[model samples]
Target: MYRKEFFVFEQGRPVSALIRNYERKDFPELIRIQQECFPPPFPSELWWNREQLDNHVSLFSEGALCVEVNGEIAGSMTGLLIDFHLDSPDHTWEEVTSNGYITNHNPNGNTLYVVDISISPSFRKLGLGKWLMSAMYDLVIYKGLTRLLGGGRMPGYYKYAHKMTPEEYIASLLDGQLKDPVITFLLHCGRTPIRAVANYLEDKDSCNYGTLMEWKNPFHQ
Candidate 1:
């Protein structure tokens, strides 16, 4: 699979960039980049307006972060901790979901979900994505929101997978597609793909999307 690079610039100073908390003011720039990347990106007005942001800021505080290139909004990532039930009830799923770069959302349990991750076209392959994700890993661990989980598209789930075995069908259905570049970069850092969800959000090509991933911050474990 292919991966993109990332970078960071602060006050014209070159420095390593990592994932940080999302600010209410970043809505405009974030939505702009979202349009450039995602086919159906979130609306800018949703984040730009203070009223809407006030309601959504808490969901992003744990795993959301952005990159700044020369005082410009180069890229951003958003994640959340939702309650999910993989096997039983009362298990709070902690994950991030729905963002251009990385979607981190946990449906119902304490499991952390990395929904999406992306780098801007102009700033690809600069190590910025990796750095941000590394930081997110730290934050998630520090907060003690372990039991990580996520999903991605697997090649087998595409139109060409008709010949796959029954077992292969199961795996492909769970392992949808590879994470976005930045998310993949994070996986390289330490996150591990655990299980595959039954249903998937297919892409434009009608291929299954999102293979779940998990990670142990070691510091906590």
Candidate 2:
């Protein structure tokens, strides 16, 4: 399985952190991270379930990853391979991720589609998210995929929804007029915005909208 170690500083001290493939033993912690990451009005029912976690590791173990700090699970990322069409990339999270089960994962797909990345509240600002993202990019290159793509949540959109259109809000973000927790983080992680998608998810903060973002593989032909 994929594994790596990192040294992250917390409270002026370095801590041991590890990036590795998810196992059945990590299911409970993964679920807890989901709850902490997406609480209340975010839909508790949408949290990661046992079946989905099982499907993820069983179907594509390489895409299901977790990060541990001081031997405790800090965060995780799940992905599935798919043949994405840049010409027609408009799709909801459910459609692209098979309703979060990722049962439709294609081993021969040309793209690594990130299904979800959830980091625990306690681990925020420690650069764990970026580490997880970097691991995924490495997986893309190792598999010779064309790109790493996903529908990035626009959690900050709700604050300005009554005053701006989704497109305008995204434009402001791209223009450095506003910052989003998710979109901004993805941008800093080397992803480029493709477009804004409506009805992409059930997130109230995002007003059910998502931003389509992608990171191209320079080594791909």
lDDT of 2 by residue, 9-90 (tens): 9998999999999999999999999999888977788899999999999999999999999999999999999999978989
User: TM-score per candidate, in order?
Assistant: 0.63, 0.96
Write model 1 residue lDDT over 90-192, tens digit each, in one string.
Answer: 1112223343222343334454555455567667656566666665666566567655445544543454345754235544433754334323444565666
Report the C-alpha displacement of residue 86, candidate 1, in angstroms. 5.6
- What lDDT does the true structure give each of the candidates? 0.51, 0.95
The lDDT, on a scale of 0 to 1, for candidate 1 is 0.51
